[model samples]
Every structure is written in C-alpha cells, then in structure tokens.
Target: MSKAKKSIEVEITEKKAGNGKTVSEVYIGKQFLGNVREDDNKFLMTTAKNESFKVNSFDEGIQELIKEFHLHH
Candidate 1:
C-alpha cells in the first residue's frame, strides 16, 4: 500500500495599516502563520518537500501562491 502525501497550503494577504504601513499576513489552513513587514519586500514560504516560493508583491503574490497551491495539490 502506498501512503498519501500531506498537503502544504497557505494564504497570504496584504494589509494596510492606519499608519500607512503595509503588512503581509500568512495563513495555513485557517491558522495564522505570521505577519511580515512590508518593508521586507520579500516573503518565503516553504513546504516539507523543500519546495518554496518567493513573493514580491504581497497582494499579487498571495493570489499567485494560492493558485500555485491549488495546482500543486
């Protein structure tokens, strides 16, 4: 019998703060992963298989990452 591989999925969001700062919110299966400052300019998310992604624009990057997760899983 073969074992099934686990799914590594996440979601990202770009939020604008009242102070005019932007933040990137990351989530994994409804759980909040963490948040990164917009000034960072780059965010990396990795899976157990060592596959990872580098996001530039938080908004667009989140959308594309979600799409990639769907296609990969």
Candidate 2:
C-alpha cells in the first residue's frame, strides 16, 4: 500500500485596490497567506505572519513565502 503525500496549494487573486493600484492576495486553503501591493513602481508584500518585505517583482513575494513555509519538497 502506498500513502498519498499532502501537497500545498496556493490561490492568488489580483484586484484593484481602493488607491487604484493593483493588489494581489494569496490564500492557502482558505487561510490568508499574504498580500503583495504595487507602490511607486516597487512591490511591497506582507505575509500572514505579519512579516513585511520588499520585492522587485510581484511574484517573488508569494514564491518566497511559499519557500519559507517549506511547502514544496
């Protein structure tokens, strides 16, 4: 018999914020993962753990966050 390993899946959503800027929110199985926002051509992201970081690219934030959580093997 073989056991199935659990995998991590993240959901990403991009929407216009009230400031009229693009905001991307990440969620993992209904749990708030993190959010990345665009400001003055820079990207700022805050993790669900309240850890804030600056990223040059929008996707970098969530990708790093996932790595931080050790979600991928």
Candidate 3:
C-alpha cells in the first residue's frame, strides 16, 4: 500500500486598493488569509481578524499570516 502525501499550499493575488495602490492578497486553500501592502520601504501585513504586522518583504508578510493561522487553528 502507498501512503498519501500531504502538503500545504498558499495562493497570492495582487489587488488594487481604493487608493489605487497594489496589495497582495494571501489565501490558504479557500479561506481568506490576509493582505500585504507596500508602505514606504516596508511591507504591512493585515490578517483576516484585523491583526497587523510590519515585515521587510512580501514573503515575510505571507509567513506572518501563515504563522498566525497555524497558531489559531
């Protein structure tokens, strides 16, 4: 018998905010994860629960959201 391999997948999409700036939307499966926006030279990440974080890069923003999701779930 063969065992099934399980993996975690994340999706990111670029969206236009009301102010006409681009933001990255993160999703885990079908659930909405968070949004990462570039402000000055730092990336601002905001979770679905409205929690916020300031990161250095887009990848860091996504990592923060994933950490929050794992902590909560």
lDDT (tens digit, per residue) of candidate 1 on 1-70: 9989988767667789687977676677885544544445566544334455666765555565465546
* lDDT by residue (tens digit), candidate 2, 6-41: 887899989898888888988878877789998788
With a 3 Å backbone cut-off (N, CA, C), the pairs that clash in candidate 2 are none
Off by over 4 Å in 3: 1-5
**Which regions in candidate 1 have their CA more than 4 angstroms from the true location?**
1-3, 39-73
> Considering TM-score, which of the candidate structures 2 and 3 is the better prediction for this target?
3
Report the poorest 10 consecutive residues by lDDT, candidate 3. 3-12
Q: Write the per-residue lDDT of candidate 3 for residues 1-73, one digit (tens) a residue.
A: 9989868899999999999989999898999999999998889999998888889998888888998888988
User: Best candidate per TM-score, number?
Assistant: 3
Q: Could you give the C-alpha RMSD of every candidate to the true structure, in order shown?
A: 7.6, 3.4, 2.7
CA lDDT of 10 in candidate 2? 91
Clash count for each candidate, listed in order shown: 0, 0, 0
